[model samples]
Target chain A: MHYFIELFFSGLTRGAIYALIALGYTMVYGIIGLINFAHGEIYMIGAFTSYIVASVLSLYGYPLFATVIIAGAAAVVWSGAYGYTVERLAYRPLRRAPRLSPLISAIGMSILLQNYVFLAQTSDFISFPKLIPDLPFMDRYADYLGSSDVVILFTTLIVMGILTFIIRYTRIGKAMRATAQDSTMAMLVGINVNRVISATFVIGSGLAAIGGMLIAAHIGQINYYIGFLAGIKAFTAAVLGGIGSIPGAVLGSLVLGLTESFATGYVSSDYEDVFAFTLLVLILIFRPSGLLGKKESQKV
Target chain B: MLKLQNLRAGYGNIIAVDDVSLEVGQGEIVSLIGANGAGKSTVLMTISGVVSCLAGRVLLDDVEIQGLEPDQIVRRGVCQVPEGRHIFPQLTVRENLDMGAFLRRDKKGIRDDIDYVFTLFPILAERRNQDGGTLSGGQQQMLAMSRALMARPSLLLLDEPSMGLAPLMSKQIFKIIKRINADHGTTIFLVEQNANQALHIAHRGYVLENGRIVLAGSGEALLTDPEVQKAYLGI
Candidate 1:
């Protein structure tokens, strides 16, 4: 029972991070129907940005909580800039080309960003600061969940709630939903479809940055290569949830996280990646549209 | 209010509207009537900037808006209620209407327009909270027109507004279209397959056949022309 409880909390924390990252993938896909293969690099950039900010601030003797907040904010801004630039420079030009053209461009972007970071930053792992301060009282419950896990879980819930509110109530949010439904109609209605797509990437990449920062804090280290594996897992989560559905992406991430946690806990950790892929394959075989994806119908 | 001069447009290389030229005067209802493949919708699309003009010019108030993006054209006071009433299926009727005013920022004016739209189509008011896709065919058509009106456009391009509608509903929609033009002084450029009804309501009309304007005159003149009487009026 204790082991199960421990694994559940761990899974929940991991799922929250995955959900955050997966949202970027799902939203970009929802609006533009592009997979945004370079999304993972955005996450990596977020972590690195946070690391740099915190390191620079620590030299000035900033405390842990303040450092964490400032670092997260810096990461959000940096990653958001990257997201907008990637959409404008890399993806925008290929938007009207063959669909496969953008896919190739996205893959190319991912590799280029990865190498860019590798050359700029070190290939060796960087030790992240302990953003979560030590809580002596919670040490007794450390086996069930750490203070970092609790922070990650709560922050994710708050951010997700805020995101839901923005999408539901804001005018821009309505425009986004409208554009996603039918861009031609959206354009005719006077919504700038290009602006809406850019906004999606900006918001999506910001969320990914938060995810990257939180995960870096939790795991105690990050590297340029961390984004590759983490991004693939989050992409899988988005696909599982239903590529275009926001709620579905969140649900899918949790499921993927729990699956990975339990697989690692009970089964050999060596086969963790194997188990995740197997589950995705089985889900695809049974429900190809994904768990919450709408089945497309031919209008004509 | 709107002018097309020697315009040629199409999908890829296949021309759908070739060398088509027409004018829609301010505060008047003008219509383009044609057969199934006569390029009626293409003409409107080219004017609205949805389809790029391969040649010639589109002048909105004589500024030449040819090849501008659709949203830019819309911002310049032309809004198109496209064929098939493309309402956002997942959005409520109210949201769908709000989307029409997406580019506008005047809160009080937007609210007033919503009230005005509701008055025009009371059914939309009743189903304000319902998803637009759930509306009946007639109701959807009403919603589509009302949505365009929310933009407060100077020139409203309505394509096939009466398509798939019952006679009673189509008549009601036409009455409202006339009312909108009269009350708001909005210039209308209508495209329809129902030639008799379209010409009956329009102040002037053009007959488009295979991407060219084969005939043009006052609504009554075209309605009574021998070729139009035979080909369109089915005399």
Candidate 2:
């Protein structure tokens, strides 16, 4: 029972990271129907931003909480600006072009960002400092849970709660839902579809930044290429959960995380990727609309 | 209240509306009648800034609104109930109505407008919480019109409000359009394929053919015109 609980906590932490990344994928896809392949690179940028902020602020000898807060906030702002610029430069112009144009452009952007960061930051892995301090009571169950795990879970829950409130009750949220349904109609009814699309990218990228910062702090290391694998896994999670559904993305990430944890725990750790890929294929074959996706009929 | 002069607009190289000119006076309902592909809908779309005008001017109360963004056009009190009743399917009926007033900031006025919409279509009030997609065709049309009215526009551009409706429901819709114009003094520019019913209610009418206005006259004069009877009324 204790072993399983330990696995559950670990799985939850990993799932939280995947969920944050997957939401960026799902939201950009939802509003504009683009895969936003560059989303993973945005995550990488976040980690880099946080790392730079931490290094610069480390000179001040601030406490762990203050360092994490300042670093995380800087990462969010920088990453969000990157997201907005990416949309305006790469995605916005291709909006009216053939749908394939934007997909190709997104792939190009992913490559561009990866190379740009590699050239500027070097290809070597950078070690990250622990952002969360060890709490006194957590030492009692150190084998089962860590203070970092608690922090990740707490942040994820708070973000999810705040996002839910905004999406459900706010005016901008209603406009977003409306645009997702029918953008042409949304415009006719006076909603600025462009502004809504930009807002979605901003929020999604900010969430990804937080996820990047947390994952880097927890793992204690990051590389320019870390976003590639994380992006693929989160993309898989988004597809597993219904591609456009917010709750579905989180649920899919949890499922993916638990599957990975158990497989690594009981089976050969070398087969982790194989297990995840096989599960994705099986799910696609059995349930093409994903776990929670409703089969939508196109109105001709 | 609304004027389009020599408006030329279309989709990528294919002109849907070619040099069409028209006008709607305040407190009057003007109908633009045509067959499918005659540019009636395109004219409305251009005026509402959904489609760009290639070469011409769209003026709303002497203000050049051509080339303005769609939301900007709506802010200037030119609202369009687009073809096919393009209501947001996932949102509730009440939510759909609220979105119509997206630009307005007056909370009391918005509340009053919503109440007015409900009075216009009581079925909407009853189904305020239901998703717009769940409504039947005629009910959806009502919701679409009500949603547009939520903006409280001085000039309303209605495109094919009677399309895909039963004869009875279409008649009811026409009756409501007349009531809205009479009671509120809204300047209306209506586009419809159902020429007979449209002309019967309109104060003046324009006949569009092949992306141009082929004829224009008072509603009674057009109804009695020999060419109109032969081509549109199917006499």
Candidate 3:
């Protein structure tokens, strides 16, 4: 029973991270119908940003709490800048081009960003500073849930709540939803569609940056290539839940995280990816539109 | 208060609105009537700045607006309800109306306008919380117009407002169009393939043929003209 609880908490922590990253993919896809392949790089950049800031702040003798806050804020802002620039430079010019063209541009951007990061930051993995400290109350539950896991889960919940509120009631959120539904009509109603697209990129990048910071702190390591695998996994989660649906992304991530955890716990860690992918294939075969995706309906 | 001078625009290599010039005075209902391929929509789209104007001037009260972005043009008090009543499928009717007022910052005025549109189209009021896609065709038309009205536009460009609607619904829509104009004192630029009804309600009407304005006259004159009667009114 204890062992099962441990795996479950671990899976929940992983799901929280995946949900944060998957939201970026789903939101960008919802607005533009384009898979922002470079989104993962944004996450990597975020982790690196946090790493550098945290290291510098600590070196300057800043308190741990202040250091963590400053590091996380820096990560979000820098990642947002990168996200905005990526869209302006890579996707905006090809907005009217064939759908395949923007898609190709996205893949090219992903590769370019990865290489850029590699050249700028050494490929060697560096140990990340523990930004989350142990809680006094968590000492009793430490066997099942670590302090970092608790913080991650709690932060994700708060972020999700804030995001839901923004999308449901805020003016910019309504504009985003409107643009996603029918961009032409959105324009007719006086929405700056380009600005909305840029906002989407920035928001998605910011979320991924939070995920990057949390996961890097949890794992205690960072590298330029970390985003590649994490990005693919989060994308898989997005697709599994339903690419354009926000709630679907969260549900998909949880399912993916739990599956990986249980499969590793029961069978073997070596086949963890195999189980995760096989589940995705089965779900796709049965529901091509994904679990929560709306069926494609054409109006005559 | 809108004027177009030799407006030439279209897709790449194909001119949809070729050398079309017209004026819609403030508070007048001007209908541009034509057949399926006559470029009526292109004219309105160009004025709304959706399509790039290849060559020509689009002046709103003497201010050139041809090269501005679509949203910027809308910000200048011109709003369009394009063909097909493109309602946001997932948005509720009320939310759709909110989108119509996207640029407006006056919260109380927006609220009053929302109430005003609900009174104008009571059916929309009842379906306020329902997703727009689930509405009937006639209801969707009502929602689209109400959405446009939320902008409180000085000049409302309507493209094929009667298209794909039943005769009874079309009549209701036309009646509401006139009411909107009379109530708000708004200038209207209406584009339609349904010539008989458009001409009847219009103060002045222009006949477009193959991307060019072939004729212009008062509503009664065009309605009774021999050439217009033969080609357009199905007389």
Candidate 4:
């Protein structure tokens, strides 16, 4: 029973991290109908940005919490800037081109960003500073739940709640939904569609950045290549729930996380990737549109 | 209030609208009637800046607006209810109306306008919270018109407002169009394939054929004209 409880909490922590990254994929896909392959690199860049800032601040004798906050803010801003630039340089010019064109451009961008990071920073796995401190009250629950796990879960919950509010009631949120539904009509109604697209990229990248920082702190190490595997897993989560639905991404991530945890706990950790991919394949075979995805119902 | 001179525009390589010149006076209902392949919608799209103008000038109150973007044109008081009543399918009817007022910052005025549109189409009021995709065709048309009205446009460009609707619903839409013009003193540029109904409401009308304006006159004159009757009205 203790083992099961431990696995469950671990699953929840993993789910929380995956949810943060999956949101970026789902949102970008929702607005533009393209899989932004470069999104994963944005996550990596976020991790690196936070890593550099946290290290510098810690070296300068800043308080732990302050270092964490400053590093997080820096990560978000830089990731957002990169996201905005990627859209402008890579996707915007090909907006009217064939759908396949932008997709190719996205893949190219992902490779370019990965190489750029590789050249700029060392490929070695640098140890990350533990930004989340061990809370005093968590000593009793330390056997099942760590302080970092609690922080990850709490942050994810708050972020999702805030995101829901923005999408439901805010003006720009309405504009994003409107553009997703019918961009032409959105323009007729005076929405700057380009600006909305840029905003989507920035917001999505920011979420990925937060995920990057949290996971780096939790694992205590990060490298330029960390984003590749994490990105694929989160994308799988997004596709599992429903690529274009917001809540679907979170649900999918939790499911994926729990499945990986239990499979590893019961069987072996060596087959973790096998289990994740097999589950995705099974889901695809059974429900091609995804668990929560609406079947294509285009009006003729 | 709106004028187009020798406007040329089309999808790449194939011209849809060529040398089309027309004028719509302030507070007047001007209808452009044509057959299926004629460039009526293209003309309106050119004015709205959805289709880029390849040549010539689009003047709104004598200011050139040919090269402006679609949203820019809307900001300048030109709003289009495109063909097929392209309502944002996932949005509720009230939300659709809110999108119509996307650029407006006046909260109280937006609220009053919402109330006014609800009154204009009481059916829309009932379906205020329902997703726009779930509405019936005629109801969708009502929502589309109401959505455009939320902008409080000075010159409203309507593309095929009566298309794909039953005769009764078409009559209702036309009546509401006239009421909107009379009530708001808004100039209307209406494009329609249903010539008889459109001409009846229009103060003046133009007949477009194969990207060219072949005829123009008072609506009553065009209605009685033999050429228009044979080609368009089936009279």
- Alpha-carbon deviation at A14 in model 2, angstroms: 1.1
TM-score of each: 0.98, 0.98, 0.98, 0.98
Q: Compose the digit string of candidate 2's lDDT tens values, residues B36-90.
A: 9999989998998888899999988888999988988888888999999988888
Residue-level lDDT tens digits of model 2 in A204-285: 9999999999999899999999889999999999989989888889999999988998888888789988877887898899
Candidate ranking under lDDT, highest first, comes to 3, 4, 1, 2
lDDT of each: 0.92, 0.91, 0.93, 0.93
Which residue pairs clash in candidate 1? none
Look at candidate 3 and tell me the lDDT of residue A132.
Answer: 98
Candidate 1 structure quality by residue, lDDT tens digits, A128-213: 98788767887999889988888899999999999999899897888889999999899898888899999999999999999999
* lDDT per residue as tens, model 3, B51-137: 899998999999999989999999999999999999999999988998999999999999999999988889888899999999998
C-alpha lDDT (0 to 100) for residue A182 of candidate 1? 91
Clashing pairs in 2: none
lDDT of 4 by residue, A149-216 (tens): 99999988988898899888998899999998898899999999999999999989999999999999
Predicted candidate 4, C-alpha RMSD = 1.2
Q: Residue A298 deviation, candidate 2, in Å?
A: 1.2
Error of 2 at B76 (Å): 0.4
lDDT of prediction 2: 0.91
Residue ranges of candidate 2 with Cα displaced over 4 Å? none
